[model samples]
Target chain A: MHELSLMEAVRDQALAAAHADGAIRITVISLRVGELAGVELEALRFAFPVAMAGTIAAGAELRIESEAAECHCTACDAPFPAPDGCCDCPRCGAISRQLLRGRDLRLLSLEVV
Target chain B: MCRDCACGEPAPDPAAVPASAPRELTLHTALLQRNDAGAAALRQRFAAAGVRAVNLLSSPGSGKTALLEALAQRLDPTRLAVIVGDLATDNDARRLQAAGVPAVQITTGQACHLEASMVAEGVHRLNHQGISLEQLELLVIENVGNLVCPGAYDLGESLRLVLLSTTEGEDKPLKYAPIFHGADLVLISKIDLAEAVGFDRAAAHAAIARVAPHAQVLEVSARSGAGLDALIEALGLALPAVR
Candidate 1:
C-alpha cells in the first residue's frame, strides 16, 4: 500500500547514484526485498516506472531478489525461519531473541551508463 | 544521439541488455533510511528536552481521544501536549484542546501513516501555538486509526502504546500480531462496556500474552475514569505532583 513512496525513495537513490557516477542513463535497478519488509513486489513493480518516468532511470529494468524472513533463538542457540520479527522458535517453542533477516528493503545495485 | 532532441527516436530496449558488459555500482541503501534519520533527530530533540514522547496506535473508535482527554484533566495541562493525526478532520485535536491542553492536528491528505517528519511538523506547530518543548514533560502522539501502516513507522517516541477496545474482539492481537508485538504497552479500552458486550476478558488477555508477552496490559474505561491512575503510574508521570 505504501510501496509507492518506497519506490520513490528507490528512484531518488538510483538517480543520486547515477548522478554521482556521471551516468546519464540508469540501465537496471536491482533491489533486495524481504518477506517481512512490508513491501509488495508487484506493487513496487507497478510504481517503479511511474516514479522513474522522465528521469535518468526512465525505461530501466527493475530486478528484484526476494529473501525469506529468518529468526534466531537464543534460548537453544538455534537459527530458524520465522514469519515476522517476533516469532517463537519451532524447535524449542521459545521466543526468538533476534530477527536474523527478512526486514530489508535494500537497493542493492544499479547498472548505469 | 542529440541531447534533449524532440525527434521521435526510440529509447534503447531494456529487456535485451547484455548483462556481462553493463557497469554495476554497488549501492546498498535501505529505503527507510531517510525516515530513520528523521526519527533519530526527533529522538535526540526529545532527549535534550527531557520529555517523554508517546506514540499511541489503535483502530478507529477505540477511545484514544477520550483517554487523552482524561489524562489532560488529570495532569498539568502545561506539562502535557498532544498531536493527533486523522485522514480528514481535526476533531480529535479540538476535543483534546477542549480538555485545556495544547493539541495539534496533522491531517494526512493521502498518506495512511504518520511518519517522523509529520511529528516534527506537528511539534513545530504546537510550539508555534505557545507550547514550548522545554516546558512540556510529555508529548503524546495519537496516530491515525489504523494498525498496519503505523506499525512500520518509527516516530521517535519514548514509548509506544497500542490500544484495543473490547468490542473489537478478543482475537485482535492474534490478527495483528506484528503491531501488537511491537507495542511497549497494550491497553484494553472501554472496559465499562465489556460486560454488556460479552467481552471475553480471559481470551483477550491470553491472546495479548501469546502475541505480546513483553508488553504491559492495562484495562481502562475512559468514560468511568477507571484504570487511568494505574496507566499514569506505569508511565511514571507522577500524577499527584502534576495534578
Candidate 2:
C-alpha cells in the first residue's frame, strides 16, 4: 500500500534529522496523522517496522496522534468537525464548501540518544 | 522529594547523570515535504515555460487514456504532449502516440502513484524526443490508475482532472472524497452508456456537488464525441493563432 512509501519518507527524514543532531540512536518517532489524510493507521503501523529496518530507528517506538477533520461552512460562516463525513453545516444546514483542517501527516517530534 | 535542589530530601551526584541521555527533538515537518518541494519547483518551471499542465487521476478502466486519445484528435498535435504513468508497460503511451499525440510513458515498477520526480523524468524523456516543454501549450499527465494514492500527490499541474465512469456507481465521489475534493474538473465518462447501464445522473451529480462543491462537472462520452468541445473549452488549451 502507499503507507509503506509514506513510512519510507518518515524513516528517511527521521534518520537524517537524528544524524544531523549528533544523536546516536532514535528511541521514539512521533507523528501527527489526520483523519482525512487519506492514510489508514493500520496500514501505517504495518509498514513502520518494514520501512525503519536497518536504520537508527530500527527499534524505535512509533507514536501517532490523530487530528480530527474540520470543515467550514461558506453560507453559515461556521466551523465544525466532520466526524460523520458529512460536509453540511450544523448551524444552518448549508453545505460546507471549504475544508479548513484535518488533512495533515506530519512528523511532530523525535526522541534520540 | 527532589534529588538535586536545595530543599530536596537528598542531594544528587553530578557524575550520576548519564552523558548520552535521550533528547527530544522538535522537527515539525510534513511527510511529503520532499515531494511538495519538487512539485513547487516544477510548477515554477511550467509557469516560466508558459505551459498549462493538467494531472488526470482515476481508477482503473475509468477511461483516462480514452479521454486523452480523444483530446489528441481535437488539440494541436505539435503543441500538446502527454506523460502517462502505470505500474508496468507503456501501452497507454503507445495508445496515445497512435492517436497522433506526443506521449511519454513512466513505468513505475511498484508505485501506485506518480510523484513529482517521476513527472520530471517523464518531461526529460519527452524533451529527448524533441518535445520541449516551452513549445507545448498543454501538458497532460495521466497519473497511475488509482483513486487513493494519487490524491495525496501534487505533480505541478495547473489543473487536476478526475474521471468517474458511469459503471463505477453514483456514490463513488463520496466514497473517494479526498480525490474528488481535490479535482478542479470532474469528468463523468462514458455517458453514452449511462442510460443503458441505469446510471442515475441526478444521484451522481448530487454526490459530486456534496464532495466537490467548487469543481465543474462535465458529462462526456469519448466514443460518441459528446462534450469533447466543452472539455477543450474548459481546459482553455490554445487557439489556432497561438499554434
For all the models shown, what interface RMSD does each have?
Answer: 3.6, 1.8
* Predicted structure with the largest DockQ when compared to the true one: 2
List, residue by residue over B1-243, the lDDT tens digit for candidate 2. 565576856665557754478799999999999999999999999999999999999999989999888877778888889999999998998999999899999999999999999999999999899999999999999999998889888899999999999989888988888787788999999999999989999999988887776789999999997998889989986534442
Winner by lDDT: 2
Model 2 lDDT at residue B100: 86
Q: Lowest-lDDT window of 10 residues in candidate 1 chain A?
A: A81-90
Off by over 4 Å in 1: A84-86, B1-21, B241-243
TM-score against native, each model: 0.87, 0.92
Error of 1 at B179 (Å): 2.4
Candidate 2 deviant stretches above 4 angstroms = B1-19, B238-243
Q: Report backbone clashes per prediction.
A: 0, 0
Residue-level lDDT of model 1, residues B140-187, one tens digit each, is 999999876687788999899999999898888877766776688999
Each candidate's DockQ = 0.46, 0.58
Enumerate residue pairs that collide in model 2: none
Write down the lDDT that model 1 would get. 0.86
